[model samples]
Target: MVLAVKGTEQEELQSRDRAPQSATVSPTTGFFFTSPYRSLSTQGCFAKITQPAADGDNLQGAFQQGVQQAFAQARQAGVTNPVLCGAIPFDTRQPSALFIPQQTQWFERQAFMASVKPTLAALPTIVRQSELPKQTQFMQMVADAVQVTGGEQLEKVVLSRLLDIETSKQIDPHALMMRIIAQNPQGFHFHVPLNEGALVGASPELLLRMCGSQFHSNPLAGSARREADPLQDRQAGERLLVSSKDRHEHQIVTAGMRQVLHGRCRHLHIPAVPELLSTPTLWHLSTPIDGEVADRAENALSLACLLHPTPALCGTPMLAARELIAQLEPFERGLFGGIVGWCDAEGNGEWVVTIRCGTVKANQVRLFAGAGIVPDSSPQAEWHETGTKLSTMLRAFGLQG
Candidate 1:
């Protein structure tokens, strides 16, 4: 939904490859564009601070300032409805610090649901692929980069191409988002898991969303999906728990989180053990961390920003992994591995790591998946790992591949 602001000039801010529609807003105000890039976004102007982290470095203050600046700048230049989103990066590994207020029945007092009739153009049927280099070329470049960075010798990098197909159906983006929320009221949902390919349910985690002072976030560290056969499902959970490679990957993610949250929060609870968590297709060794903010210096989204590019989504020894990723992969990640969520005036919101997802367009849909590559990583296995992840998104779009 395009917003019309009462301003004259428009700022040509950032890149155009973003998820469609999803917005964040305060209860008193209407909806606003939460991020400059929505789904397939990566090139927006991101501010990175040098840090052991600071109290004042947060999303709430930045957003409040951003709103003021946007409107003020608009008035000066004569622009209207300046679409924007603010992100904060915190180095914590716990459940999101954002709190989302309970949606009481009174808030739903009216039959506010309305049909979203879209006059979308006829979507084209097309198959597209990212230009990835050969496995050997990719690995050699990664190895060389790791050596230069004074890091451990790099392992293999997992890569997968999505065979995405588009249908002419115009689904209600917002209603689908709300449906996820209503179904999983007790957990994080509405993550905008794109409807294309094998991925169906967008999320069981709320990356970020807000209503007044409340913020909500659920960062999933582990995953396991229930299999049709009960015994097999149990075996998969066990596999995720005991596999050294998987455990090693999860540890990198969890430890990075601990480093980020150290002094920023209170009543912080870190679990010493990990449990098995499952989705429909796979199982993950999962650990859920929760804590409260002591400084009120940062809002949940800002904190989430710090945790962006975690080892789970990215790879371990972040610098090393990122560098290696740049060398090994042929296409830009865009927003495939970025953050997705919503925020409001007070800076309260949630954002989720963009993973297990895809990008939808008129001509084609691109599915993305990656896995941690370690010494023991097998190229074939890593290939299958990504394939499993891609299936979920395909299911959502009513497509099978």
Candidate 2:
């Protein structure tokens, strides 16, 4: 559904900007969450519970307790069907967050209508785009991976690179979000506020979604860049389907996820083969896995916790891949490759893989993308893959390659 932002200039500003208009009120943190699925869009927060040092091993238990506590608080405020929305970092040990929205709004499918066109007009023009890891350095890292393990210790590892774009003016998070929504109508769109900036993106991968005892996950891997020509685009997708390397990479993720869900789900159904899933910029091999939860009490967040940082995002031999990532990558991957979405008192909600996203603060935006590395992976090819992924956000910012 098209969202018509309130026309007043004050309404266009950050939520913090409108707080002063109210009578001396205690400060409260707010969050925004949405998905291509219209039923999932939500904004505003009545009360929020934060666990700054949540235990990684006990994440499920902690999340359950936190949700119950937040629901209790929401009940006292006469709120019903209350939901929690936020993100979990790639590193489970890192501090993560979820917010219980007090007051929220949901939208239906339609064009976003506004008296004034919500254009990218307010965002600063892109002045420069720089890669965090130079091409040569990234190539060497890939070579090191191939040489160190001799192709046996690690089957695949996802190596990521950052693209930092400096702009001419401060970025308006809302405007950026609007533009993203306009461009990628079918994506899981989100705009989450951070202490210093906002995390925004339109992700095509669903990490997990639960409703009652049923659960579903669509994990994507093995990407091929899209082409403008219809014939070439079809050929690209066909190539991805039969590529031995791409198929192997895709298989590892599917098998890992199935293994993780084995004891937790019943009547699990995973396709023997993957199908093609396409975004505007790339085509990916995707598998849809579904099953009924063995324990009805296990909520969406807990299930997401279990499956997050899948081989699709990290790599096989998860611990080894993570260690390699730490030693090789230059910057910290805060919330990227994480999970984002909402869950309610009931164990029903949707969580999506936070890829094709970026962090926007003031006059700068840092975008991230990763390519899975295997025994025969090419560093130059991986670098190009990241470039293709970054284009999803770059195009949204009204910037071109």
Candidate 3:
């Protein structure tokens, strides 16, 4: 434990472990976050973290060690089987907004949802609306990405768009989360309270999950808007299934995923063809990959950091895709494409891709969604895809695209 350090050395590590700085939800003291499988609700702060999380493959400052430091401090504070939960930024180099909760409870999916009845309550009226890059600019960014991908230097890049709305009153996050879950009941729903606002979403992609010796990930790419009519919807999915360009975009993600998993896992399984997954607004090509960890010490966060910014989230040839995303994107992603979940002392947790999500503050909400761009990608189609993606949250607010 870090307790062995003496004098100024101990003070330094302790300073790095201070509680996360956060503002309260309008009325609640803590936060509530969830995955498709379970929910984590925290009442107050315990020993929190100040260190930047998971410094790449460098185990010295990565998840396993970070957890040991955090949980060890939790034990000293008299907490039992404590868990750290919060949002990890898209960039690993940034400081992590994680904290050990003084009071933490885990709930089964059905039980938690059963208690949260869907609400018909009207959210605050949106008095103003704005887009980050504007439609034309976003399309041009996609076109540029397409041209870059058409070359050998880059294969694919995922770009995102933002829609900011100012409401007549502060939004009730719990009610909004309920509406979101009611629409996409099977997705990963989360609401993590932050210093300014709350990071909330219902993500369909599982970044990583670990239970005992095994781990699993479901990476999604290539999508088509879901039509209201049954026949057209099926047709849309079928077309996406047969699209050479979409398949190529999807394979780039799977290939990057396999490479990362192969280095830390054994008995890997990734199906050759991706299956279609349907949400209320779109259909996605998804691959369910599973395997046993080669290293017993691999916690959920460690593995997640290693495989993070997957081509599905970032783009292929990871670094180049990121550089381009930074250049073309009008704003910083913050936690948009990162992860939101929790891990306990046992090193098991679920981290879902932060998609179909938004940042909810007093009287406002910022929604985020991204589309993967490939050589044959159409900027207009990409625009529509992202709009459909954003609708998952917009509909929750009783607003339509």
Candidate 4:
């Protein structure tokens, strides 16, 4: 049998003689990438998906078609289960970067796959701003409105903005990480750099994860730190789970996900309760929703797109809050708060929301963070909460606190 790749110039002529067929590429031999920026433009020859559906119309059908197309491309290229991937823009104002493999490889004997890592810039890091008397007055104005409306019941509504960082050609994502290390060194650090886009974060929230149909989604809501001891950590988690304010916030996210997955998945189980997860400096109210798909009909991207901008990331009233963000947030989210992961033609993949993340271009970069505001939320506290969340992404870059 003749083997070939589909994306590069040389493969085009080579593939003209081959017959088309559907094939499954193993997890070990597909395309892979780690994007850090959410806005840069990227291209892939085969299996590249286009813009997402504005609404959930024909999305299932479209996703199915995409899967078929990917298979077709794979067959012609003589590779089984070619690694396929692309970006879905959420927070950025610009079009997403989509990447398919530029070349295909035969997997007969190699145990490890190889990919090129792109140069990237690190986002500027900032320490917690000292609270000033006037800042409280400003937050008070926002707080009063929230309380009057019952939105103030939320444990902590975080709020943050994008900051600009200088960039240069001799880019060193690792060196830049060292600078951040001087600040916030403790967190779940992650780095994914690609020609199309990039993402770096220490996220506190888990949008959704599927492990052989036993799905797990630990939605983080409230944030507090364990008191400087192991027992204290457990106590902090327990306190967070029981806090009415925290529960209210957790419910909004869990319920929103439930609504989004309604009729699409089966055996959906949501405990009539929440659990507490304590981090180094804060405690969060978290809940895990488990379920299986009635029909393995949807791919991870399609399902994830349906649940984008969850109440945890957006607001309880999703449509309204999205509009508010459009009006209030100065910049677009781009890939921020969007879903990122890998899947195949079967629609099975893992996607995580791009929270606690930033964007990097040639030399410049922008980091973003936000908080949910409700009636009980304190603006000052919310601001601090956002700082905590941003630390996730910053710490990944070794940003100093």
Please tell me which predicted candidate would have the highest TM-score against the true structure.
3
Tens digit per residue, CA lDDT, model 3, 332-393: 99888988788778778888888999998998889999999999999998999999999999
| Candidate numbers sorted by TM-score from highest down | 3, 2, 4, 1
Q: Which stretches of candidate 2 lie over 4 Å from their true place?
A: 1-30, 36-38, 41-43, 52-60, 110-122
Q: Candidate 2 or 3, higher lDDT?
A: 3
For residues 42-147, what per-residue lDDT tens digits would candidate 4 score against the true structure? Answer: 1234534443434422354644455556556665655444444544566422444433443333221111112212223454443333322234543664464365
Error of 1 at 212 (Å): 9.7
Query: Against the hidden reference, what TM-scores do the models get?
Result: 0.62, 0.87, 0.91, 0.71
CA shift at 50, candidate 4, in angstroms? 3.8
lDDT of 1 by residue, 123-182 (tens): 222343342444454455434433443434433233334444544454444433344223
Per-residue C-alpha lDDT of model 2 across residues 1-401, encoded as one tens digit per residue? 11111222323222222233323211112355455443334445555545532342233566456667766656555555667677878877676756655445454434333222546664677888788898898888878876654556788788888899999888777678778867776788777666578788889999998888998899999999999999999999999999998999999999998888898877799999999999988999999999998887888887887887899999988889999989988888989888888877776888899898998889989998988888778878887888889888888888664
lDDT of 1 at 255: 74
Give the whole-model CA lDDT for all candidates, comma-separated.
0.44, 0.75, 0.80, 0.52
Task: Output candidate 3 Cα RMSD.
Answer: 5.3
Candidate 3 whole-model C-alpha lDDT, 0 to 1: 0.80
Pick by lDDT: which candidate is best? 3
Predicted structure 1: clash tally: 65
